[model samples]
Target chain A: MRKLALICVVMVLAFLPPPLLGEVDSALLQDSVTVDLPEPPAPPGNVTATDNPNDNGRAIRVTWELSADDTTGMKNVIGYRINRAEARDAADSLWTEASDILPSGTTEFIHSGDGEEDGPDYFAKNYDFYYRVHALTADTFSVSAVVGPVQAKDNWYNTGVTFVLLFVALFIILTVTFVRIARKGKELYIRPLAGIEAVDEAIGRATEMGKPTLYILGLGSAADIATIASFAILSRVAKKVAEYQTPLLVPCYEPFVMTVAQDTVRAAYMDAGRPDDYDEDSVYFVTSSQFAYVAGVMGTMIREKPATNFYLGMFHAESLLLAETGAMIGSIQIAGTDQIAQLPFFVVACDYTLIGEELYAASVYLSREPVLLGTIKAQDWAKAVVVGTILAGLLARLLVDLDFIKTVFEVSV
Target chain B: MKRQIPMMILSTIGTIFVLAYFSPGLEELEKGGSIFFDVVACFAFFLGGSNLVRVHIQKIARHNPGWGYSIVTLFGFGLMLFIGLFKLGNPLGIAGAPTEPGSWFQIIFQYCVAPLSATMYSLLAFFVASASYRAFRAKNTEATILLVAAFIILLGRTQLGLVMTSWVPDWLSIAQIPNLAVFIMTSPNLAGQRAIMIGIALGVVSMSLRLILGIERSYLGSDS
Candidate 1:
């Protein structure tokens, strides 16, 4: 009877639930008591979305203030996540994750769509999009209020460049006013460049020695500004050479330059009333390769032993090579280039060096036209304005802690 | 008519480009102009190549001075052109890139042209020495200053500056040779360079305006 009773009790005990069993073990019962979990981070505030300015459209810039709980109170927030949707009242399922995970303290996200016309990720230009930022803890998230219905579209004009536009307009007005003033028969004073003075002397020396004057147009294309400026100088030089009846050798690195140079020499000869003396073969095309051109010029320098060498236009590493070779041959070297890095080499190796703007000024000095002289005067005035502005800005910053002058000149583009 | 047409075109295009900077819509005009220039330049290469051949051939035929060098130039030019055009030794066959690795053209360019270019470039070392010797003669006050600056810069680039200034105090560290060299470069030299750059920028702006307004016409030769 007792054994049967004990078996019945064991069967009843086996049918009991786990919680009832935990009552037998105090440690298990204590472990079963629920403990409160950490709260999710506070939602970020002042969320805003706008079309990204100065872009080709298809992008929105989302910005928000960081969450309060992100930096203080528990400081459990790890990062933030950005989400976007096409509909304003979109459900959580409809919201697409724009950013995977941004570190805490981040307040901006550029939600850009693929630039493709047709694609799954394509955000069509001029389309309205809504954005939300989620402040995240280890396991919980608190989302910000929906920012917008912001439409992304291209701007016809970038407002950020307003200051630059104003400055440019001012310059244009100043230049035109000065140009008109000079056209009224006012003689604009242009400081003489030593390089310009040397050009005539070099040509005269070449004529006296009865040796050719070698002129290298450098390795720039005809479209290059330096090369274009050089053409003006070359015309003047060719005219002088023609008047003196001295041989002029021009080795061009580009065919277009060669053609232009040929035409320039021919015209200069005609202008000098010595068209019969102009040789078509004098200004000829050399190999377009930089080093090959250098090699050819070096060979010419060695063989021809020119009395004067004129290194002008845009020169690169070969600047010193040519200048050194000319110096070695005991020829007077005159060089002019806009390349600043090559200036030191030319200054060291050549008898005369046209430093930076001096090249352009030398061209103007050679042309001696009223219009060109007017431009130089305008340029000088503009430079004066720039210098005054810079000095004023510096003094203001140093003395009064004012930055408005600096801000005025700050170019956005 | 010739001068007027060219001037009108230059003014129109220059104005368009300047306006394009402010208007994104007209940006394509700038790009299109650049593309047109590039295409024209590409076409000009044919003229350049032909002229090279013509000039060299004339020299060779007439037995002119340095005619032997003309033969070498022609042979090299012709051989390279033939190898590149035919895509000889190109693993991917005729349509492959002429400069593809393992190709005859690539081999020749890598082995011959590149080395020759480097050799020529290396000559600048010797040239710099010669130029420096002449320029740093200390003939005038400015030349003396330049010579001293160059010497300091040279010392700063070597271990000698560090060894010489190793005993300098922390307070006067900037007066040390290396530090002074750096100051000269970063402060005075940089200021001078910036000043020059500003002048160059202004010059470019003025020159561009003159070109656009048809005031600067020497670029168009005697027609202007």
Candidate 2:
């Protein structure tokens, strides 16, 4: 009994000492905790803030030398924290954290703002700002000397895109020179496209078959280059349709495109002396939802089975579906698009395909205008220049391991 | 005068937009122009909707071929419009957005429109197979090369490719189906796409110049 009592007392002594002497033990624990605390990382140096160039006056670029401990000394820096003066001429000591704490090794940060005067993220333009760099460790930080009084502002020129400017200028000069040359009655030879030749043939066949000619301006907006090009082609086709006294159906994907098509058709009919025959119902709007549009168009194709189908404009995945449907219905499909991915699908299903630049050239070819021809010539010349540069760049890389030529072609945007 | 005014507007706006590319601090102007276009397109949406209704109603009145589809289209359009505007069956009531949970608008889209759209999109799978079949037919030298490349690609996508080429030595790994497929795609295919892209870029530039200079006016249906 005495031994059991002794064991019980021993257990109580092992577990109950801290609670019995809690006040005295707390002081000792605090002292030990203070001794193990982490030291602050060394301060970074040479901090600077400057106006970011080639942008609206909304951001300041802050940079600093790396903390000594980060690379060579204690290696304790987890990251660097950036703080900016909240207002113009605000004291450096009174600052707001600019962004998320930058991870270690980055020595620069673009302190951007929301570009609004009232928003929480706003950093006012033409406002003076100061910055401080804090080398951070797990539990403490060492602040660098303040540096700034930098004002955010904009630059007139974006030097990063200087190469782009040079190319654009060259193109403009070339285009102007060729256009002037064209105006002087100089003949420019443009290789004939099979698709352009087939347009008349397709229309004639549709006329003979006594069926409608379906002209889809595609799903592009009225402003799209391909859609604009198609408008020219459609005008010519509408005139021919009027001459032949044949039906021409134009189902549009966009409302504005439909309006434009209606105008072009009416004008063509007027030109052909068949203004009274022009029906406003001929050009109508369809839905804009992608697959729904496809479903609607497919229904028309299956029902109408138009003798000739002309799909000319910007298309997407629906290109294959539409072309394949046209093919199944045994329609003579003449397709044109600058979309490279859809080109293969069109080439496969359509009787004739206008690949890439051919779509743009189609309208010009039909119009046969000197000014438009000049632009085509300019395009060819530009393509030649691009090809020549690529060749030269390749040769330089292959021969002397020179990458200098490529740097000239590297556009910022 | 009709053509001249539009051309002038086109050239002036086009020039300013082009200038914005090379100049700083003009981004706000571009953004404003983009917003203007969005507002115009938003208005155009009503034009499209009204036209849709008018066309379908005409079809029904005339009892045209496929008049049944016109009824279906009109019903779907009207029902969706009513449901969306009223926010009927919305879990959060009228205060919530039209697309909120349990709304009839969401339900119909989830059940009807989306599935119908998917059905149309799924047709592409069968269409692609058919297209590939025709595209891969060995009719000529180019077709033969395409067939070979396509065969390699199909094989590479499966585990059988690794097993089939396992006997080949590591030094000749370039000849392996997977590696060959990747090489064809990244090198030859990319090169062709880039070439086409370059041509397209020049075409866009040329076409834009013509429009901006008012050298082409057929799109406006003008003879002069």
Candidate 3:
């Protein structure tokens, strides 16, 4: 049979001596490597040097047209080398190489300096320098004409982010207008969120069950916006918890967040007139290591069996781990995060989930201050504008083949 | 006065930060701000470390419910700190990095912490399965649609889908499981995610404006 014969052949090949098998291929490799040398390739053309834009004056941009040999000619050009010097006729040995021979077909290089002052790569700003590129072959190279006397200087403003400036200006204008209206005693309507509505219910469940509520301000530092938003929600939760006199556990991942949470909780208890009952140990610092923190929280959840778990902050990969653990413990869980990737996991595991902007909206909605409401309304209008633009842009691209909107919003780094 | 002073300072510095993005002249100021935060974080780290020790010691002294684990935690924390601070068992001495290869700190991190973190992270695989099972159940109309889509995605990711639909004609290739899966992800899934991202971006801008303008202050604890 063909199968049996193929197996036999494979066994024979596998059992063959390694040297005997490699001999044929090794001969072919040697034949390939003993290639005859050719004349030097054509030199690269039109070398240019200019100060790099949008940076400190530490770099110069060098570019050249590809050699004829690299294109429609012999096609033997392997790569290019860039070099620079200060003098007009510096010795070939004195000119420092900018980088390792750049890979084949490279037409541009950002010749920059870094780290040490006395090193070969020490290119200072505001210096008149000359640059040249070499088109290389196997054994020979042809050099392009030196382009020189170009000085690098820093630009005070990054014109690349002009689109960003425009958007920020528009947003500020819209926000200020709405905020003034709101300050004039107008009631701005915000759609009710299920996650915000469930805050009281989840805490009430914990109160009725006589089990503590666990609040996790996730792994983000205090500077994170999600953590900042969570602080507002936590203040609201703490007020309710204090009024009900329910046991509350807040384990924080960052020390700064922990300190802030302590202040927030203490203030809430003072406001609720229950400062006497607010335990200092109620909010404490956990380990800073990610898994260690998760494990510690998991241990507490298993031991205490808290009736409600509120995870409201910037959770990372541990979103599902925390949520799944809570689900296993049969606790009512309400979670919110701005992380779009983690939303699906939270949606699956938690009883109530706040998706994306809802996390911020919850804070604004809960506070109900005129200015906050005004800002939220402004954000809504911004969203509507973006939606309309997306639709119009799609139509423009499809029917008219125009992409001006795309170009207008494109952010340059 | 206490709150208002800080609010005023926040507004001033925050406005500078916003301008710093577009103005290259403020680039150095931005880096300086970051360096300042790092310096503050070092102090905060000490607070977190001391709190860890104090909380654990108190729990151990009082014989709390999980006092046994506290001892292990303290011992591990103490050992790692001692080894790293002294650079003990490092091939390179004070001149080299504390985390030099074959050093006690690096060895423990590589063998112990890395594996433990990886083990915890790998637990996500099983959790995903369990969560997806609950999520993909056909309890409702939307759930049924999700289950079907998930089924297609699962098949398309493996060799089975190619074998299942390899004979489909070129004109009807879109009906192939792999192509269908790609369409679902790149079309519907991507569209939804982009919509959410736009909303999230707008929210961040609005929230940042509130902070910069001092419209929202509950984060400073009930001040709103």
Candidate 4:
């Protein structure tokens, strides 16, 4: 019986699977021996996630310090991996990989969120976002403690331009106050502009020569401030032409401007007590095409040989062409434009030129109206304030390292 | 009623736009205002086109002194309008862009109008030369200074300034012609430009206020 039982045990042992037979040997080896492995890289330090300021609130800025072991002893670290999760999710929630392989030594990453309504990667504004940085190696990764709950939100007011806003408010108040004072029959003084004085002489010269006075209102629409200012000067010139009985030719580049010019000329004629002399055909629309209008004006100058030419309002490349043609025709030319680039052309080609603000000042100077004169006074005061601020800023920068004064002038929006 | 109503509307719209500029929340209102102006201007183009046609036709009918030129103007205007409006010769028909490739409107614009505009633009070079000759005359102290500045600017823009100043030592680099030209442009020139810009800004502010307050009404052709 003993022999038979031993035989059965031996047979069972022989028939067992190889893995089951090897399990006892593997357990013994694990207990007896241990393999050496390198330690994982240290996690990044001082991780921060914050909303990027002064923006439309579509981004979060993530920053972190390098791990201690990254570039030192062991030096197993290769790069970094950035992970993000919504703050509203669970503490152990699954994180989305924002970047898998940020290069070594990177300390900052700006995670821009799409603001478009239909964008696939759209990130909701004002929602808190959590961020984590992982120090990565060939074999292992060590993640930093999650830096969290930063929400991006839009600011209604850009506090950066507070200084500009205050200055503008002050200027408006000063101008309105002066306008009201002038309306109460108060006389205000404005220095005469040489360009304004030259207008009458140019028109008178045309009268003496028995030739027409050509006025070009430029290519700007009636909504343009320069064009509006030109209308004021045109009113004065039209009145003078009517009184002198000299033929006036006003060619307009814009339709609305033509309508405005016609009304201004007719009013000026009536003001001069020569309503019968006003001709509707005098003020008319030329072609709206820039060069086409230039060609037509050049043709008129060549054919009619106007004695006096007045070029005013906003001008572009056409400025030199008109001024040169007028100069060639031996016409006494007076040009005024607010375009800084075109001013040089006018100055070189025309007899008298209004430089920058002089175009705006010319109208008030020509009319000598108390209300307009008051605005000029207000402008002078504003200019003084600007000059004072500039001087103060210069002094402050030279004397100290503080940037408060400079910041006041730095308009961000 | 005619003058007062327009002035009131101008003032109200102008004030609203000014307010919208400073407030970021009201940015949409600013955009709306701009769109409104563009729409109005588009409609105004019809008025301008009709007036252009009417004036030229009158000159043609009366056999005016420039009647020959009027005929050319009318023909060009009519041709452009017909081609552009119908999108003639466009592969995709009227639904296609007026300036689409191979279209009659595109061909005319590219071959005819473009070259004509370019010719006009090129004439600026001759005008510049003539104007510069007259302006650079050293008749006075300021004119002499201006002439010197112009010469420096012109030379600095070319390789001549660098070749001429190559002999200068590094220690006195500021004395080099090109360096001097740069100094003039970045310092004194920038300062003058800024001053002029500031003056312009203040003038615009005052002028805008006058218009908004109804203080300046000569633009409406009403002295009162």
Q: Score the docking of each candidate (DockQ).
A: 0.50, 0.61, 0.44, 0.47
Model 4 C-alpha lDDT versus the unseen true structure: 0.84
What tens digits encode model 2's per-residue C-alpha lDDT throughout A259-325? 8799899988988899999988889887888898888888898988899999999999999999999
Model 4: CA > 4 A from native: A1-156, A180-187, A273-277
> Which portions of model 1 miss their true places by more than 4 Å?
A1-49, A55-106, A109-154, A274-276
Fnat for every candidate: 0.55, 0.68, 0.65, 0.52
TM-score of 4: 0.79
The CAPRI classification for model 3 reads as: acceptable
How far in Å is the alpha carbon of B162 misplaced in model 1?
1.8
List TM-score per model, in order. 0.84, 0.90, 0.87, 0.79
lDDT against the true structure, each candidate: 0.85, 0.85, 0.86, 0.84
User: Which residue pairs show collisions in model 1?
Assistant: none
Candidate with maximal DockQ:
2
Model 4 agreement with the true structure over A40-152: per-residue lDDT tens digits = 78899999998875555667788999887778756778999888888635465578877758877788887766655798667668987899999988877798989889887
A17: Cα error in model 1, Å: 34
Q: Per-candidate interface C-alpha RMSD?
A: 2.1, 1.8, 2.2, 2.8
Lowest lDDT 10-residue stretch of candidate 2 chain A: A23-32
